[model samples]
Target: MNAPARLRVAAGQATSVPRDVAANVATACSLVTTAADQGARVVVLPELFLTGYAAEEWRHDDSLALDASTGSGGPDERLRPLADLARERGVTVVASAAVRRALDASTLSAVVLTPDGEVRAPYDKQHLCGLEEQGFFTAGDHGATIVVDGWELGLGICYDGSFPEHAASAAAAGATAYLTPAAFFTGSDHRRDLYYAARAIDNGIYVVFAGLTGTCGASSFSGGSAVYDPEGRAVARTGADDPAVVVADLDIAEVRRVQDEVNTVARDRRDSLGHRERLEVGRAG
Candidate 1:
């Protein structure tokens, strides 16, 4: 079924408690509640939010990784609250964490909990950065897109958004919006915004960023979570240095207008260099 032209989404920016899944999950639940109260049907949170973004510190801590073992499909007990919240609020929640069956097999993953209380296939971060590459996370092999309210949302992590092809693949896979969970450091807002805006304009898709805020380990996050339209305009954004949520309505009509009249990047894309593979699509139950 096709969703309406407009869908309201929320980006929740907050700090994670170092290695404390309980506290972080509690905060995430609160954010979901707040976003739902504001009528947002989809809510996004920061990268590795289950445990604060301290790759060097928790890199080898097996206890910090959420269980992603593929067997009898059961949601991680620690994250059951989020699934329950999603079901109760009728919202799709995108949140990230380090997940693995073992320490060496860990991946930084974005968990998509839908309104039906199912933990969909998690989108693993495909691009690993400095500390993340140093034995902390294994890069994902393919991209993931999910259906929420009939909108195809492409999933990306912080570093993944830096590459143009990453977002392009999602757009090629029929995604109208790219949802990113980022843990951008303080003072990198310019680069962050540029990357997001460029990706949006390049693919003619909305770019939604949900960032970490406050201090964590040796890094401080100035939350500049935002939503950029297909034309790279800032539709909505949150303030810095604090926990906040920004809600915006994403209209497919704008994307259609841009692709049809303004930017013709999609039509100009070549199959050789441009993305050709359709991303695995998970539909909300």
Candidate 2:
């Protein structure tokens, strides 16, 4: 018989520090260590966690602008310690940081760090909101995925979660779980919860959304870190504006069962017809 595929994951709702890389890294390290101690094999953090989600701040500061890591440029020096912690604790961590893509000097990206301290797949935000466009960060070309503990995981940032294509492409790529690290602001909780649940139901996969809480600069984050099961059920969740680590144990077999039962319907399609049409148009372009 195949080994039972069960894993315990943690969603870290942290307080981000705008323009403070060292302090943010320190907080992330501490959170990872704490999550590992709690037997969390996989820990997910919020988007642009290291430098907070203050896109406006990056626009004015030269230091902050120069500090972004190009997704392919490997890990940042400040984040090396967290990588070391992951190696030491044997926990697979998914954290986000403001990254600069070397290929296009005009773009800043979000990256995922693997357990072995290596830069895993990078999912640039395809949807930029408000001041993000003014910050000069270009969108990513395509979505990406990572495999951990017999599970295919998809990566997306805050705004990326707003788009169905991001999660749909990952599911089509055989991802059983969708992981999003976000810094969603106030009044956005309802939308976040709705999207997460909708994504799970539509794709027949688990959705884990880790968000930042508390205030950073002029923005206040709505901390509703959540984990949705394959059937669009929120198996684990935290209250609004709470800073805590939410843990959930997922059974991969249930995901398979749900897909077989609910995903066979035409309405539960893996590829939306609209998305397919767009892909065809882009290819022909």
Candidate 3:
């Protein structure tokens, strides 16, 4: 039999200020290290943690982009040092930023760094929020899912999590875990909490929300980072406390048990998604 499948994950919650790339990177690196030291192999940060969400500088600057149209975000410009951080700390990091496509347009991206310090292919956020059009970021064509170790992981940004379609799509794609990196402000917690549990239980998968914890412009980021198990129960969470790492251990065996017994995904997987005017394979809503 295969060795028992287990993964230790951490959601790193911190504030990212506008126009402060170095500081944001430093904070992420520190949190990544802390998570690694705490035995977490995977560490996730809030959306746009590199340059801060809603930062005008990111919209205007091409060099601030994570990847260029040439298909590669060359090491230095892409914060290749983050790979070094992962390599040194023996952890994989998931974080988001902007990838410049043109002088006036960029893609909101979720970047994955391997333990070997390699920048893995990034997942661009497919859904944009209200008034985000005021910014220069472009909507990605589709969402993405990837396998990490034995776990199939899916990526979602802030607003993307609100729609059941995104998580359902990942689940249909064989994602056993979903991570949403958000910079949600006050009054958004309840909805997020509701869906986080709903999505996990509906799909019989684990979910993690890595949230921010401070103010930006007129908004106040509420730092309620949390993780939920396949049963849709909160396994770990930050008490809206200061910047912190909310860590948890997930088991693939448990996921299998849930599927074999409870098996919700199997019952509704086909009903929600389809091809050609057909509902998406995983989209229930």
Candidate 4:
């Protein structure tokens, strides 16, 4: 199927009720409805939003993580509400949660809930931040892309977006946009501006960053959720520390324009992206 020439997307910034999956899901449903009403075909939510970004909470109480076993044909009961909402609203909802992939295994995963009521966790966060996350969640093996209305969106979570190779891999995989669900802290404005925009410009694709707001455990999130165009311009954005939803119409043609015409970064990116040689430059003594 041919991708849409222009696709409307949204980034959701909301507060997470610590250790409360049901409440968080309910909150996400409301935000999803808002985005759908705004004509967004896809809405991306914050990281670990299902049970909050409380890594210690997850570590202490494993029950907080939803069972997302690979063999399951449908979402678990806890995930059904959001799935039903997506189907009813005909919007693709990208949400994240701590998931138990197996009895002994758990990971922080971003799931794509399609309008057809299908749910898939195409990406598990590869880069875990700090000791809390590193001690609690298992890192994913690789990056992945999800399709909504024929628009390919590469998936990442928080720290994963900081790595240039992560977004570059998505572009190489034919993704027109990169979606990141994050929980950035209050003083990370410089990071929020640099990382998302850099990823968009570096890959010559749309970048949607959905961040958390308010407090989740010991940390306070700055909800600088935004959507950056291919040229790294902020097309849509929410105020820092504000709980809101921001939407933007991403023109796929603009991606082509930047990649092929204006920005050659995407077009000129070599396949040896993973290949790097350390070079030493010494001043002539």
Expressed as tens digits, the lDDT of each residue in 104-214 for candidate 1 is 577788878888898764688888988645466778887998888799999999989999999999999899999999988899889988999999999899999999989
Q: Considering TM-score, which of the candidate structures 1 and 2 is the better prediction for this target?
A: 1
- Candidate 2: tens digits of C-alpha lDDT, residues 53-98: 7766764333223334534533556667877788888888887655
lDDT of 2: 0.74
Cα lDDT of model 3 by residue, 225-282, tens digit? 8899998999998856667998899999888888778766644566634556645577
Provide the lDDT at 173 for model 1: 87
Q: Where does candidate 3 clash, by residue pair?
A: 273-280, 273-281, 274-279, 274-280
* Cα misplacement distance, residue 230 of candidate 3 (Å): 0.9
Clashing residue pairs in candidate 1 are: none
Q: Model 4: per-residue lDDT, tens digit, 25-137?
A: 88999899889999999999999898788765775445443446562245766778999999999999988877777766778888788888977777889999989888878
Please estimate how well model 3 matches the true structure, expressed as its whole-model Cα lDDT. 0.78
Best by TM-score: 4
Judging by TM-score, tell me the better candidate of 2 and 4.
4
Q: What lDDT score belongs to each candidate, Candidate 1 first?
A: 0.85, 0.74, 0.78, 0.86
lDDT of 3 at 111: 75
Tell me which of candidates 1 and 4 scores higher on lDDT.
4
Candidate 2, after superposition: displacement of residue 21 in Å? 1.2
- Candidate 2 residue pairs in backbone clash: 69-100, 70-100
Question: What value does the lDDT take at residue 218 in candidate 3?
Answer: 50
Off by over 4 Å in 3: 1-4, 55-58, 133-135, 263-266, 272-285
